[model samples]
Target: MDLPRSFTIRESSHRILNPFTDEKLATLGRALHLAPGTRMLDLACGKGEMLCTWAAAHRVTGTGVDISSDFIGAASARAAALGVADQVTFLHDDAASHAATDPVDVASCIGATWIGGGVAGTVELLRRSLRPGGTMLVGEPYWRREPPDQAAVEGSMATSKDEFRSLPALIEQFGELGVDVVEMVLADQDSWDRYVAAQWLNIRRWLDRNPDDELAEQMRAELTTAPVRYARYQRDYLGWGVFVLMDR
Candidate 1:
């Protein structure tokens, strides 16, 4: 199984596939104080950046699973490129039913919580793969401020205000799930710009090369409106972060 060609085309150049910069990702790794040989299981692990980098920096070993065969291939190459091929592995498979063959020191589902339906279900799913005292990392978006109306929500790319909770409420959500919020690294507007604006350029470059591709028109339409929509709604109203949690 694989992701839609359009999805890969839009993010072909993205290494992290999220709003997070490499520096931010490194900071999170350091903050975790990852011990050598720590084992991690990452679900929906786009491009395997997190696993590969951590394998290098922390000498951790991990397995990453994603639905995108293209990403999995890239992730495998990345592992070899980083000289950590032996430490990490990437699988092209659905993450929704993925459970670690052995309990791991850390389990994560970053950005793609929909693999487990939603935050609560995702947390539950990750817990199945985590050791008793191991950490769980969840990356998600929250509302920076309450949207004034449905239009505002739609502008932020959310179908409803309930799609994301406020920052405090998100923390409370982890608590309700019987997990302690231990640490977090958040994304700023600049990070959002880096993530969203980069897509326009990728789409433009692709269109220049493959103007007659089946998805070119759709990409062109998105490029036309994405910038304004992002700056006006997403950059201000939405905030994203990777949170570290432990069973309470």
Candidate 2:
């Protein structure tokens, strides 16, 4: 079973797919207090960069689950390349109904909450794979301030202005869900640029290689407009972050 070629291409280059830059990712790792022997599960783990790097750097053992086999293969290679093959595993699987092979210290569904519908639902979904006292890590979007216009919301990838709450409201929602927001790492403008702008180069290269592909037109449109849209709307009105949570 093959995903759309565009999806495969994006999955193959997730260091750029993600909205967080490498420095932000490292900051997140430190904020989570990830350590040796910590068992973790990464849902929607694109290319498993975070999992593999954390495994090697912190000596953590983890499993990364993604829908793309290409991502799983790349993740496996990354683990081995980092000499942490024994510590991390990658699987091509659906994450919506994923169950941990065993209870783990951390369960993460970063930047892909659609697997559980949305943020609150995703937290519940991650809870199932976590040990009694384990943490749930979610990377999600919020508003820097309430969007002043529907177009601004659309630019941030939401259908309506109500799709995401403001940052404090997002944290409060987690509290209402009975989870303590223990740690968080926010994405800065530069990080967002890295995530969105880098895609332009990849898309440009793809169009060069596969000029006749049907998706090429759509990607070209995105490439032409995304940078301006992102700068005008998302950069000014939206925010993104990864939160580390624990049961209250």
Candidate 3:
């Protein structure tokens, strides 16, 4: 299945779909010390920004799989623009069903761990495609602090606090899964603001251009209240990062 139309509309301008800025992503690519011929398998690789950029910067070859045809098209275009078309392939397919023909040096499920149900399951899924001593990248959200109330939970877009662990607990989880935390690039408040606040502008611009669109009203409502919700709950309660892991 493809991403919801509203989500695509809200995030149409985003090159990287997660709460990661271009600089932070670049830092991660460099920190990995990827060799010239490193191979990567990225599931739910939104817009292929990471793969295309890494291929250009590190000479890494990779395959990116996603369910959205529109996103896949954008990703393909990105690869070409970055002069890495030959180094990366983008497939419009369900990540859960995709398999690598060969093991990869890095396997990732960035910001979409739901592909394998959750963090633990996503790790297992990525492991299947990774070579021994390879890295695994998992992008996920954890609680920055305990939510003090139900409104806080709802504001964080979670049904309950059980949905996410605290940051330290999340690290423990990686250990429990038999992986060592190697490196991480976490989102700061500014990065979060950039990612979340951008939706309002995109939605507002869309509403202005497509006043009669069927989803216009829904997006308008989101634009109206999302900021308040974010400031009150999400900005302080949620922490997100792409954690680098290697099997212990």
Candidate 4:
């Protein structure tokens, strides 16, 4: 019925949640040749920025689905603010089971692949929403280098170290899913820093506003320690990218 608080808070602040700067986002749109009338289904569409921005850019219509109600509300407001409410819709639902009412030109599962278990399963789930020959956009992390220990991997995820794959293996995993990596945009260390560090600021702000709230204590603990863990483990050992996949 709910997603983690971190996701909801991140949704309310679009600028911080988006690790990719404008230039990078624009590059992704261009890489996909996003033009007017192109349809996209943004799975795990946090705050709906990717969907809303693409809708505005392409004059297209689409739906965004996420389990987080707070995220869905924020995303809906964003679409309205962009004057594209009619063109896009946001729903509070599980991304894995969100079947489209109509087939789309593209389907995307960015950053949140747990809905499908992993990249391969996620790709298969998204493929159900695409028209024949349509594209799927997947944003995922890959290991830049191996982590030094189990603790390093745990810091990168709330889950265990078994949750991820190395970069080359991830590419091959996509191939195993019957997807060709048509295009991709990489995130540099600066982008990673922006994404991970911004969460600390959000947590700090939350603590300031709600000092007595039980959740604030958890937030404070996370704020105090997350950055060090990220910088020490995840940041140096991992890289992320948005890959454009086409059914082959």
Q: What is residue 43's positional error in candidate 4, in angstroms?
A: 1.3
Question: What tens digits encode model 1's per-residue C-alpha lDDT throughout 96-135?
Answer: 9899999999999989989988999999999999999999
Question: Which residue pairs show collisions in model 3?
Answer: none
lDDT preference between candidates 1 and 2, better one: 1
Local distance difference test, candidate 1: 0.94
- In candidate 2 the C-alpha lDDT for residue 129 amounts to 92
Instruction: Report the lDDT of model 2 for residue 60.
Output: 89
Report, for every candidate in turn, its global Cα lDDT versus the true structure: 0.94, 0.84, 0.94, 0.81
Task: State residue 24's C-alpha deviation in candidate 2, in Å.
Answer: 1.6
- The lDDT of model 3 is 0.94
lDDT per residue for candidate 4 within 67-161, as digits (tens), equals: 88887888898898989999999999988888787899989888888799888788888988999989999988877877668887777663554
The TM-score between candidate 2 and the true structure equals 0.95
* Prediction 1 TM-score vs. true: 0.99
Provide TM-scores for the models: 0.99, 0.95, 0.98, 0.93
Residue 34 local lDDT, model 2: 75
Candidate 2 per-residue lDDT over residues 87-153, each given as its tens digit: 8989889888898968999999988999999988899889889999999999888988788888888
Shift in Å, residue 119, candidate 2: 1.3
